[model samples]
Every structure is written in structure tokens, then in C-alpha cells.
Target: MQDFSQARNQVLQQIQHACDLAHRTDVAKLLAVSKTHDADTVRAMYDVGQRSFGENYLQEACHKIDELKDLEIQWHFIGHVQRNKTKLIAAHFSWVHGVDRLIIAQRLSEQRGHELPPLNICIQVNIDAQDSKDGCAPEDVIAMVEKIQQLPHIQLRGLMVIPAPNHTQAFFDAQALFKKVALAYPTLQSWDTLSMGMSGDLLPAIQAGSTLVRIGTALFGARDYSQDR
Candidate 1:
């Protein structure tokens, strides 16, 4: 069996260290990016006190969700939300971190079962300005936020970005960008999470005000895409 305890400790220790260096406490959170991991692996992490998990693919995540119904898991859909998948994404995930379009926000708000709590949302911003990236352009966030706020069954939490890995200058730029948007949205909801960091840049991301870090390889070892396929 994989030694997940060590991995979990390593990740928590990093978060603590980063929080200390930043002189900020109780701000950041670790969202274990459990994409491509089986339900058994997810349950293992759950056994060790990891509650929030992020998943990319919708179908696999739904399967895992069904299998682990007994556990109180906060499933965050960190993947791009396709129009067709809104039904399942709306039904299963407690949070959606990649709501890049107003239509998606509308669809989710519309499809969400009224019995459930309002869906927490993070508008994905193209932090690195990569044309190939999956989020909305940085300039478009305010406009998107304005419309999404009017939608029911969904609350605007903040911004999420996938900056180019190890791109030092670009990372700082993303930090600045997130700070800008957050400052502009003083009334959005709560501590507007800057979900920008990953396994490679957790420290800097936390120091720059990343309330949530989406981690995968560091916690679960390398991904086995084939297993899910």
C-alpha cells in the first residue's frame, strides 16, 4: 500500500510553513487534486482527514462520488465544465472551480437541486495569458462576475488559475492579477480564494494569498490515467 500518511504530512507541513512565512494563519486550504485516482485511493486519503478533493473528469468523479457516498467529501470540480455535463456536475459537486462562462454558471444554477446548498463557484481566469489555457481571459472576469452574481443556487467565491508551472515572473503576475480582482470584489462573499498553486509552487502561492492549493502528485504520487480510462 502507498504511504499516504507521509504524503499527507508533507503537504500539511508545507502549508503550515508557508502560512508562517507569510504571517497569515487560517487562510489557505489544501484541495487534494484527486483526478485519475480510484475511489479506494480517495477513501484512503479520507481516512487520513483529507475532506476536500478536486477532480478533472466528470464521469470518473461521479463514479467515485457514488462509491464513496457514505463519506462526507467536498468534491470540487477543477476541470473545465462542458455544457452537456452540467447536469451531473451540478448534481454531484459541492464546489465548481472552473466556471469560465456565464452560461455555465446559469446552467449549474438552473440544474442544481433546490434541496442542496448553493453551489460555490470560482471563475477560472487565464492567469498566464496562454492561448491554449481553459479559463476566461483576465480582462473578462469582472464582466463575468457581474452576471454570475445574479444567478441563483450559486455563490461567487473567487478566482482560480493554472499559471505556467515554474514560470517565476508569470507566477508573480498571476498573484498580482488575483489580488486585483479580489480587491475589486470586496462584497463577493468571503476570503476570495486565489486557487493558483500546485505541488511545484505551493509556498510562493500561499505567500501570495492562495487560500486554496490544488495538489495531486505530491499527495497521491504520479497519476495513472490509464486506470480511469
Candidate 2:
């Protein structure tokens, strides 16, 4: 077993270091991407002060959520959300970081229970993205925001991005796009989160004003992809 508390602290320290290097007073937060890890690992990390977590797969996340219902964890759905999974996501998740389509956003908005607070959402923007990636073309961000503003059950918080690996152009491109999206929507109270960093390139993302970084292996060590099958 890994020393989760130490790993969590190391990540947090890195976050602060990045913030310092960027000269940012308001430091970016760390969202531990715990998709393949079991619920007990999450629970242990939570006990050590890590609250926010990101999960990619729905079934696995749902199981983990149920098992750890007693913990005060903010679950972020960071997967390629399919239409059929909308209802469950809307009901269970507090934040969604991969909303790439208007139809899916509408489904999530419609299904979110009225009694629950509006689900916080981040529009996924494909920056120098692969053909297999699921994100709105950068040009469509304004239109997506307009559509989401009309919906009552979900609040358009900000944008999420998965920039192509080791591509300096992609990282800078994502940063520019984050600024564009931020400026496009002037009145959204929650229009602040820029979910654009992962373990490999968190520094650039943070320097570019990313408010949240979804770090996995850096915090939890290598993943067990076999269990995902």
C-alpha cells in the first residue's frame, strides 16, 4: 500500500510551488483523479485532508460513491459521459468536468433533482485534440454557454481541457482558449474554474490561471487499468 497522506501532501506542496512560480496569490486546487483506485484509498486520502476527487467511468464511480457515502467528498465526473449515464451523474455528482455537448448538458440539467443544488459544470474544450477525443470545437464555446445559461438545474462554472501530450502549442492554445471563454461569459458567477491540468503539465496550466488540476499518478501512483476492463 502507498503512503497516501505523504503523496497527497507532496502534491499539495507542488501545487503551492507552482503557484509561487507563477506569482499567483490565489493558488490552484488539486483534484485527485481516483478513477481506478478503490473506495478505501479515497477514504484514507480524505482523512488526510484531500476532499475533491475525479472519476472517469460511471459504473465504477457509482460503486465507489455508494461505498463512501459517509465521507464528505466532492465527486467530479471527468469521463466521456454517454447519454444513458446522464441521470445518474446529475443525481450523484456535485461537479462535472467533461460536458462537451449541448444535448448532454440538457440531459444532465433536466435530470438533476430540484432539491439539490445546481450541478457545477465545466465545458470540455478540445485543444489540439485527437480525433478520438470528446470535446466541443473551440469556436462553439460561446454557443454552448448561451444554451447552458437558459437551463436552471446546471450552472456553467467554467471550461475543462485535455491538451495533447508534450505539445507546447497545445498547452499555450488551451491557455488562450481559457481566457477567451472566461471573457465570453461576463455574468456567470461560477465562471472561474479552468480545469486544464494533469500530472504531466500542471505547471503551465497553473501559470495560465487554471483553478483546478486533476492529478492522478502523481498523487496515487500508477493506476490499475486491468480492473477497468
Best by TM-score: 2
lDDT of 1 by residue, 48-157 (tens): 99999999888888899999999999999999899999999999999999889999999999999999999999988887788788989878887897788889998888
lDDT score of model 2?
0.87
Q: lDDT tens string, model 2, 150-229?
A: 89888888888887776657766766776776677666667888888889998878877789999999988899988643
Candidate 2's error at 180, in angstroms?
A: 2.3
Judged by lDDT against the true structure, how good is candidate 1?
Answer: 0.87
Which ranges of candidate 1 are over 4 A from the true structure? none
The clash number for model 1 is: 0
Per-structure clash totals for the candidates: 0, 0
The TM-scores of all predictions, comma-separated, are 0.94, 0.96
